[model samples]
Target: MELDTPVLDDHMHLDPDHGRGIDAVEDFAHLGGTHLLVVNKPSWHLGVEAGDPDAVDPAAAGEEFREVFERTIKVVEAASDVLDGRAWPVLGVHPGLISRLVDERGFSPEDARDVMQAGIEVAAEYVADGEALALKSGRPHYEVSEAVWDASNEVMRRAFECGAEIGCAVQLHAEASEDMSEVAEWAEEAGLPAERVVKHYASGRLAGPIPSVMSEKERLRVAAESGEPFLMETDFVDDPDRPGAVLGPKTVPRRVRWLLEEGYEDAVRRAHVETPQSVYGIDTEATLSE
Candidate 1:
């Protein structure tokens, strides 16, 4: 599928072994993308999480991240040489992995988070001066129980403190639900302007008790009350029969346009995939060769 504007996948899965190569990504980005906010999530955990069944190409992408970041460094460094620094070399640990690493790798959750935070901090300062670090959160278990919630929040906060420009996804697979107050607390602690920290993927609903994130009025209300930030996104998955699944981009943008028709200005901004790319320090306009 083709889109006139950059279609941002707020939560993307580009693995080391099976991702589009650097050249391919650059070519795609040059097509119209301000830049792809390349989140280094590896292969997918299939048959576990259910995705859309209507996409043209269902890409079950995600699994482990040990190599994602390692490969990311290589790609980001290569961007300067290959794409003339147009690559959005993002650096942030996936929020969900906080517990996974602890349970599987046997490290104290706090320590694991600290190391993750350390990488984000170092990457922000050393790699591209805090411009490129896509500080993200919205870990699935965030609102479920305090144990992982606290850990996820701490990780986000640490990344925030490091001056990383923070953003979070409004994911579907969660046991804890999103309460505006709780979300507000997380946003406040992270010092993320409500707009800057987008709650994306409105396509899927939170699995826990809650219903919708914020009502149309409530979304505006949250922005007004907190004077923080707000935005919307269609977290399109690569389901084979889905319109925007995989390499295709649709449905999500229409929903965002609907938000605009209904008076969600921030929602429009969220639709611009380039905003995060710019906020996170990816040079979208850099000249590249085909």
Candidate 2:
């Protein structure tokens, strides 16, 4: 199934041990999908233990997250063999893990934040090394104590700072709401432009960061009609335990085809090709050719 317009999944995951892995990528490609921003799962998901919360060096403890980022990069490489340069890695510590570190791993809120910020630093290094193009960071989507919340915001700021230093984008897994203007302001104050901050799994275009909305027809139509720049994703977790946890792997390309068939060729191209190129600074046409 060839496509004239490229299809890029803004957020996705592939786990060989617990999910369909690269076969999911093949499934996506089989439906004319062209690219994916393959993000790293939580540290626990990759068997990365938050060892020694009592350790003196928080940075050292954070180094454990390298395995998660590295494994994610490896997955991108493996997927790239199927989709070529279209599979880009986005690396960072999962914000939800902060709560687990404090509540489950016996880490203090401060310690958890330090460890997460350090992990973001490591992810920035990978971006610097060209292994990834964006940094993932955010406060927990659920409620938490003020201390943990402050610390999580600090960690997210570190991601913004790192992204600014390296001239890359930041993908946030923050709490879902209609307004993210405050977070956008935070990104701007940290020297990372609001446009470079993406709201992952977003439902609509908020005031601040760019929205990476799920591939639902009504949402896409609203986004397209608004004339605001946005991107689309399936957010496929690819977990075998919970089949199609978010959306299926083929959802994006299939939706693109649906949009085109419905005479939304221009909107589909803007969402799939133009918006992604502008945000990630990648030439989708060049990648699609290769």
Candidate 3:
């Protein structure tokens, strides 16, 4: 284990060829990858990846999520031997996927599009302006943003409530400080703690070869000072299909070093180890340096 210079690839999607087996995780861990947060799509959380494996559109509408949790349990258990208290799992629904689930489950007011055309019968009742819109007919956004946020909060709350519920760390995809601030706002409003939440999708504007403005970078500085436990992801993907993965092994270390140079050691350490180890149930006491 690379305990001395550990890096946590906090968020990883399952690539059919590159990410399916425990061996890959073991090797990554042996190569200084101390922590990995395996991400799985759940039906209830629909903003990023769909979690339901059986839903009509598993990637969109989302299906039963408990099964995904079950699958996660198995994956974590299977990887336990190789990880030996190093690897961990963080579980939560993506924003898009969760929105879809919230709408379908009658937990939040549906968009007009969610209503079925006339004469169409569908499961789940839709309540709009105190009126029940059958699965077919169109309705309006009697939606209170608060209501929707609360509903999502409840869903995540249940995920956290279960003792087995993996924090896997909470994340959002936003770039600017305003947008990223909104991510924190939503997380708090949804009952997610600031400490366990991580901002992994600081993609697009927040990172790239060309630098984003220093002002925009200040969001991270503020987040660091808020005394809230938040982390950042370099968002590196190691799939064979990715050019960077094929080109260089420099992305991970470079980003960590950059964060260090920025005087964001809190963010750096959290992104690399603390947040992930805490969230994914990994043994943090062990050094992860190779």
TM-score for all models, in order of appearance: 0.53, 0.96, 0.49
Rank ordering of all candidates by lDDT, starting from the highest: 2, 1, 3
Give the per-residue Cα lDDT of candidate 1 at 112.
53
lDDT of 1 by residue, 1-290 (tens): 23344333344433334434454445444443333444444112321221123323222212223344556656655543443224454555556655555655565555555555554454444334434445444455444456666766676666555442434222222333344445545555656443334443332232221122222344433433432223332222333334344332233344444545666555445434344443443333332332
Task: List the candidate 3 regions with Cα displacement exceeding 4 Å.
Answer: 1-3, 15-20, 42-63, 98-169, 173-178, 186-192, 203-270, 273-283, 287-290
Q: Evaluate model 1: give its lDDT.
A: 0.42
TM-score of 3: 0.49
- Tell me which of candidates 1 and 3 scores higher on TM-score: 1
Which candidate leads in lDDT? Answer: 2
How would you encode candidate 3's per-residue C-alpha lDDT over 16-119 as one tens digit per residue?
A: 23443565556554544454455543322222222333334322332333344445445655554555344444443443433454455432323211211100
* Candidate 3 lDDT score relative to the true structure: 0.38
RMSD list, candidates in order: 10.5, 1.3, 11.5
lDDT of 2: 0.87
- Model 1 sits at a Cα RMSD from the real structure of 10.5
TM-score-best of 2 and 3: 2
- Candidate 1 Cα deviation (angstroms), residue 271: 2.7
What TM-score does model 1 achieve against the real structure? Answer: 0.53
On a 0 to 100 scale, what is the lDDT of residue 16 in model 2? Answer: 74
- Put down candidate 2 lDDT per residue, 88-143, tens digits, no spaces: 99999889988888999899888888888889998999999998989999999998
